[model samples]
Target chain A: MTIKELANQLNMSTTTVSRVLTGQEKKYRISEKTAQRVKDLAKAHQFAPNQIARNLRLQKTNTIGLIIPDISNPFFANLARTIEVALRKRDKMVLLCDTKDETTIEEESITLLLGRKVDGLLVAPVGEKWAHLEKTNNIPMVLIDRYFEHKEIPYITTDNYAGSYDATSFLISQGHHRIACIQGLVHTSANKNRIKGFQKALADHKVDTAQTFILGNDYSVENGYESAKSLLQAAEVPTAIFALNNQIAIGVMKAINEAGLHIPENISLLSFDEQPYFELLSPPLSSIKQPMEEIGIAAVETLFELLENKKVTSSRLKPTLIPRASVKSIVKS
Target chain B: MTIKELANQLNMSTTTVSRVLTGQEKKYRISEKTAQRVKDLAKAHQFAPNQIARNLRLQKTNTIGLIIPDISNPFFANLARTIEVALRKRDKMVLLCDTKDETTIEEESITLLLGRKVDGLLVAPVGEKWAHLEKTNNIPMVLIDRYFEHKEIPYITTDNYAGSYDATSFLISQGHHRIACIQGLVHTSANKNRIKGFQKALADHKVDTAQTFILGNDYSVENGYESAKSLLQAAEVPTAIFALNNQIAIGVMKAINEAGLHIPENISLLSFDEQPYFELLSPPLSSIKQPMEEIGIAAVETLFELLENKKVTSSRLKPTLIPRASVKSIVKS
Candidate 1:
């Protein structure tokens, strides 16, 4: 029912009814009994004030916008879950915009979220450079899982380089001299750090870095499969392979299986991130596990901090190495 | 900047500015050049007209709400990706709400989506009963990948019973005397249908119904692993195990590996739904492949139809089995 009808039913002026519905009548010293009566009647009638009227009166949507590259990825999905739980604790809600890892879509999502007048934003940018995001900097934002070129923005992410270096060095300690690396998208800082970590491991061992192998592609199981096939077919296959992410690692395992090779027997496999199915794999996978929960918690915490203190903060949490059967000790020449 | 300020700057009336901004001036015989000038000025000023205003004016959000149990599941993720792509092609956007398998959270998401006045909803309900969802008959909804008690609501789902029956029969065709089944959440129609199909297969083959095995749990890889372990340790282990979903099958495979048993050697396995990593397994997993893309496309299509026709329609698609190395013939028995 319309506000006028409710007002007429309550024998109150339309102005008073509007004020009561908008919760402003109390501020104007309307009697508590009258206000309660209006609220009870409105509830009984299942009256919902038009959103436009409510929004216009409150000047706030009470919603936060979340833009992520891919919601289907376990990492991002976990992050989103954590963020949602955290926000729920604070009585706030999220408006999610999945960009599907496309730059144009990312831009469009940002604009749309801004147009919605969300109180704040949490974004995991798809690319390093986002001019649209930079141009529309009016809203508060916290970048999660990935960073942007604009260092002024607050961001929370794992130490990709350290994680990769530790993983690579662990493989080396296991006597895996010849190693292959499957990289994520080359345009991002995360992929670059991983490459640096892999190279550093080879340099520390005084191994001819040229002999060490690297393949760059998007983070997907299909890409992992293709890269693993090419690496295994090389003239001299590496003793161990490091897949940058779990999806790729799964793909690599498939390639190895297709080639009639077994993990750590014919070759070793290691990857970044832990998949729930890892322990279920024939030979449990060895990898560096990023602190997904911590990353999400920290990102939300940072977002709130920025919202409250209006300050920019950046953090990179350390990654932990999870050793499993996938890595095998190589025979030294 | 407000419309008043824009009008002052452009030497026009506030009504004209509002009209041009809302795209109503043209219908009122306002010149095209003036409207263009107003738009260009607004663009230059970077004025974002409040979304609520535009939404109220247009009576549409151009946004569809998508609620799923979990985004990390490859099946749901793939489905979400398809929906996103399909919606994008139609120049529409999706607002994703991940319930993380919590029924309360799912209900809360629906309320929030409704509060936002989304044009329509595409939901994969957590389980069989959703009284809260039923209470809201105002919103047009299309259930995707899940079913509900409310028959009136439109839904798009796979033929779970037929798929399961075909998978179980295939194992019987391989001369499997004893077959086991790993089921999903029993509260879901999908899981119930699969179980019915399994039972039907055993009855058709004249196998002792009491000897037929069934394990029920969430459709996750961990459940698969645990169920496989228990099934293997049983007094009479089945020659073949039919996992109701891919995650469980993956877990079962891992359990087999850990037990130092080879697939199709000590035991054969077949599962419902195809996972990308299935082919990567040592012995490629045999699976019933759901028409995932079709389900996704159909979900959006159904949502649009509901919005346009204001009528509900339920549709179901069939799944096909993809034969792989996981299943082997029982030669002696």
Candidate 2:
């Protein structure tokens, strides 16, 4: 039943009924008897204001839009889950849009979310372009994981440069000068920063530049496999390999298996992202573990600050190096 | 810009401007010149109908609410991804609600979705009771993965009984007389059906019921680990073990590792869900692979059918048994 029907049945104006139902009886100076009659009738008819209509009147849906590149990736999935939990605490719901790592779809998702009149947005953008994201119709948005260079959007992500540099330094400390880094999505800021850090670390350690190499163009197991296959066929293979992400690490492992090799025995391996099952593998993988939960929580906090019209800037959480069985030390003790 | 402001600038009535913008100019007999002028001005001002208002007028949001108990679970994550991709093809958007496997959260999520006036709902329900689900406010809803018995709600799920039976029978055929099953969530239909299948398989083979055991209360790695640890401590140990899900399988592997045992060498393992990394494990795991993608697509299809006022029934797809090195053949070849 609608408010109109309830009001008519109660012999009261729609305005009076709405005021009473919305808890404005005192403000409207409605008589106790009249308010009681309206309430009793509404209860009998099981009438409640249509949420959509109510939202329209208040101009607030209390919903936040969340856009991510891929949901199957455990890193992003965990991030999404954490963000949802945090938002639920704030009494907000997430309207999720998975772009499948396509820029066109990202643009479409932005439009769809904006059309829904979401209170704010949390996006992990795809592609190099930020034009679509720029036109958020003044709706506050916080980018997570990936961001554009010089964009005004506030993002919370891992310190990719520091993570890569530390991971590479550790490999160098193990007396492995020749290390191959398999990277993902060359255009992404995360990849760029990681590659930069890897190169800088090698330079700082006085490693022969000619012996090191960077390969692969996307974050996928297929890319890792193909790259590792080619690298293994080379006469002078790298002593160690650094995979940019967990998916790439899996591919590298598959290629290593196919080539009749064992991790840390044939060559050392260091991955960027840490997965829960990493320890379950034959040789537990050493990894640069990003503060994923922290990033998610901070992103939500930043978005809420923006929602409150507060000045917010980007944040980069540090990544920790977890040494396991995958990376072997070759230095003589 | 508001339509009223745009109309004032063009010295035209809101109705005329709205008609031209909404492509009803010809029907309203607005002159071609006036329509072109209005369009030009609106384009200059970047004006478009507020989507929220437009949706309200049309009484359609073209949005579907997806409520899953857990997003961190790869099984559900994959399901949600496939469903989202399928819905995107139909030009529909998904609003995801993660219930965290709590019934109260599930109820709140349902109320939240209903408030948004979603066109339909797809849920992997938490808890056994369906009293809240019985009332969808006339919105089309389809259950996925889990369902309630004797409920009119349509659902798409794996044939838990057949999958469990096949897995258990495989162990029996391997000449393993004693086997332990680590189950998840006793009340869920999937868990109940799987338990029933395990018992039926043992009965058909005439294995001593006293030798087999069923343990675990949740589909978590902790449950799998604790159960395996206690079972290993027992004087009589099962020759083989079956894990109810991927998460549980990971835990079992951990327990076996802690016990200083090796897969197949000490005890054989067969798991329920298939994961990409399963093949990469030391002794690749054997598993019952459900048609997860098919289940997701079928759920969306069922929901759309319901939206079209078609009769729908529950569907159970068969699961495939993927044999790998984890399950040892105790019988002489």
* TM-score of each model, paired residue for residue: 0.91, 0.95
What is every candidate's C-alpha DockQ against the true complex, given to 2 decimals?
A: 0.46, 0.68
Residue-level lDDT tens digits of model 2 in B145-211: 8888877788999999999999999999999989999998887888989999999999999999999
The residue ranges of model 1 lying beyond 4 angstroms of the native Cα positions read A1-5, A13-32, A47-52, A260-262, A310-312, B18-26, B221-233, B250-264, B310-312, B331-333
Pairs that clash in candidate 2: none
Q: Which ten residues in a row have the lowest lDDT in candidate 1 chain A?
A: A48-57
In model 1, the clashing pairs are A254-B280
Question: What digit string (tens of lDDT, one per residue) describes model 1 on residues B210-313?
Answer: 77788858888889989999988989988998988877888888888888998989999998999776665667789999999999999888888877885656
- Chain A, model 1: TM: 0.92
